[model samples]
Target: MSFITINNIWQEYGDHVVLERLNLQIKEGEFCSMVGASGCGKSTFLRLLLGQEKPSRGTITLDGKRLVAEPDSHRGVVFQRYSVFPHLSVLDNVAIGLELPQSPLLGRLFGAKKRAAREQAAEMLKKVGLGHALDKYPAQLSGGMQQRLAIAQAFIMQPRVLLLDEPFGALDPGIRKEMHAL
Candidate 1:
């Protein structure tokens, strides 16, 4: 079976049909790019794959299992707008997703797990070329840097599928090209 499958998918928003009988198959570890004119439902398709929206007509399957629930650990997303939390340091923002909820008292009293998560987050940030910005907040970084940080956050969890919605849309052309290369 295909790693990710969309069969006869349809989506409508009010009177508008954003996707009509759209079908797709994406293989695991394959890099695929979607290109089209505006209002072509590219972003909507991403939302559907991410389980943020339901198909009006068809089924989406991941590894042969019907996708009806949002599998938090299986998917990661990076949006065009900076999705990082403004108040947290870059390392914290990246680590937040990797941390699990412990018993409230234990979580409050323990710093070891938090430190481990931070260390992993720092490693991920370095992998995405943001190692130097670990201590900075979102507002302190440039647009390109912020986008890179977002990429790090999404990839830190090592999800099976990474959804990127026009990630380079807001960057200058040069930087956008650079990000595309990365």
Candidate 2:
């Protein structure tokens, strides 16, 4: 069976239609890419696949189950625009995703757990070439740096399915190559 299935999917906003009769099947451990002109609903389709929005018609299934109507940890997403928290320091931004799911009540991890989470976040940031900017706020970083931080944040969760929208558009060629290696 397909790992992800999109059948007769359509997304329409009011009188306008963004996607029409979109169908796809992806096997387990497959990588798929969507290419189209701007405003052709690629991002919108990603959002739908992430369960951030339900299609105006049709259904999406992951592992033979209907996708939930809301976002969940089973999927991670890096939007085309940077989605890091502007108020958070770079390290905290990445660590928060790890902390929240493990400790939902406090929205944090304490003691050694906290330390481990931070360490993991730091390692991911380092892989993305942001090791020196751990204490810096998102607003203080360049657009490419912020986007890299966002990537680190999304990946640290180790979600079963990852959705990226123009995830490397802001990076330099060298940095993009480094990111692709991950």
Q: List the global CA lDDT of all models.
A: 0.82, 0.93
User: Per-residue CA lDDT of candidate 1, range 46-156, in tens?
Assistant: 888888888888999988988855646788899767588899999988887777443343432247977788888999888767889899999999887888889888888
Best prediction by lDDT: 2
Worst 10 residues of 2 by lDDT: 79-88
Stretches of candidate 1 off by over 4 Å are 101-109, 170-182
TM-score versus the correct structure, for each prediction: 0.87, 0.96
Q: Which residue pairs collide in model 1, if any?
A: none
lDDT of 2 by residue, 1-182 (tens): 89999999999999999999999999988889999999999999998998878899999999999999888888999999868888889999999998998998999999999999999999999999999999999999999999999999889988889899999999999999998888
Model 1 / residue 181 / CA error / Å: 6.7
Q: At residue 43, what lDDT does model 2 achieve?
A: 93
State the local distance difference test value for candidate 1: 0.82
